[model samples]
Target: MELYFLGTNAGVPSLQRNVTSIALRLLEERRSLWLFDCGEGTQHQILKSPLKLSKLEKVFITHMHGDHVFGLPGLLSSRGAQGVTAPLAIYGPPGIKSFIETSLTISQSRVPYTMDIIEHTGGVIFEDKYFRVEAAGLDHRADSYGYRVVEKDLPGSLDPKRLEAYGLKPGPQYGKLKRGESVELGDGSWIHPADVLLAPKKGRVVTILGDTRPCPGVEVLAKDADVLVHEATFMEDLAELAHEYYHSTAKQAAEAAVRGGVKSLFLTHFSSRYKDVEHLQPLLQEAKEVFEHTRLAEDFGLYPVQRST
Candidate 1:
């Protein structure tokens, strides 16, 4: 899977950064794309990327902030115009439904596809054969949330040569063995899959949090994640200011990632005041002091999420 950052700035847009929006490209995993937050100009950001609007299947909003959801109406309407007939699902806090409905109504936009709005209450929001999504309430100015995406373990590779050695040709029996089921041969001998198949590959976990201060349950949600995407709206010196504004500093985000035992930490949601690239050096340095694997995210940057060895 791959994460594409549409906008990485906090509160407002700047020359180098926009607001807050991220697109998780799951085309190889699920043949669809999932969006997190839809900050203003997010659709315009997507237009500059390789992502297709028709491939969008679901959107998860963190809060009702204007920077987090102002681009929803335009993206939804554009999806309809692109002839995406599949149903679209959106998960967010309570006010999300009203915001979307009112915006669509006021604009008189006609979407040809059915939209499913789920107001989650800090629990497992979605699950399927391939992946599962869990949500938790964050400590933000509004009812913000954090999402954890867990991919299910994939089956081990099957050896055709080994199967052929047992007088078994490639057929349904191979399928059964690949699924961890024992198969009976004509000689009344049972062949176990574990003896020949490779070990099952464990899935990866990704945790992304919305605008929030240092909050509880972040460690639980981000524990052992392959990557933790946290917001660092300020530097270490302005930590008190960040807390007062219900945001987090780079040091605090790094501390959470270290406590959560995540493999890598990606910091986003930068304040507009740090417009110069050099101005963000302090934030990166402070975060790296705590967690060496931490990196700052840039607008329109693509980050690949891979399973740990």
Candidate 2:
């Protein structure tokens, strides 16, 4: 799985960064893309990347703010013109249903595919065989949410040497054993898979926080996560502004990551006051100083989860 940061700016689009949007590319038996937070100008941002609008099977809205969801109607309308006939499911806070209904009604837009808009409260938002997404309310101006996308635990690798010791050759039966199935031989002896297989590898966890301040609920939601994508709308020195705006500062985001025991921290949602992103370097540096693995999220940057770690 990989995260494609299509937009990384806050409030409005800037020359360096657009609004907020992200695509989670999951490669399993099939290729699927999960989108989080379609901010204003999101469709325009997606055009600049390699993502297919048709492959966006699901969308999770963090809040109902204009910067976070103004692009929803436009993107959904454009999906039909781009030959996206697949049904899409949207998950968001309580106001999402009314927001989508009012927007689509005012625009007179009708989609060709089935669309399910779920007004979420809390807990697990969506779950399938490959991945499960859970959500919790965050401390923000509106009814904001934080999402945790967790892949299912993968099967343990089979030990070839141990398989040979059991007089088993590499064949169709070996594949069955790898699936935790027991097979009996003609000699009335049975071989168990648990003896030859290693423990299941825990799945990687990626947590995304909407516009929020440092809160205990966020720390609980992102506990031990592989990647914690937290919004840093201001520098460390702007703590007063952060509190006033109901947003987080770079230092606060890093503190949450450290307290949550996250392996890595990705800081995004930059303020649009600066012309060059170099101005934001010190803010990111402040985060990295606190959490050694913190990194500033750049537009079109792909953050791949390390498997061996």
Whose lDDT is greatest here? 1
Q: What lDDT tens digits, residue by residue, belong to model 2 across residues 44-113?
A: 9889888888889889999988888989888998997787789999999988889888888898887788
Residues 221-254 of candidate 1 have per-residue lDDT tens digits of 8999999999999998898899899999999999
- lDDT score at residue 47, model 1, on the 0-100 scale: 94
- Candidate 2's displacement at residue 219, Å, is 0.7
Error of 1 at 234 (Å): 0.4
lDDT of 1 at 309: 67
**What ranges in model 2 sit over 4 Å off?**
none
Give the Cα-based TM-score of candidate 1 against the true structure: 0.95
Candidate 1, position 196, lDDT? 60
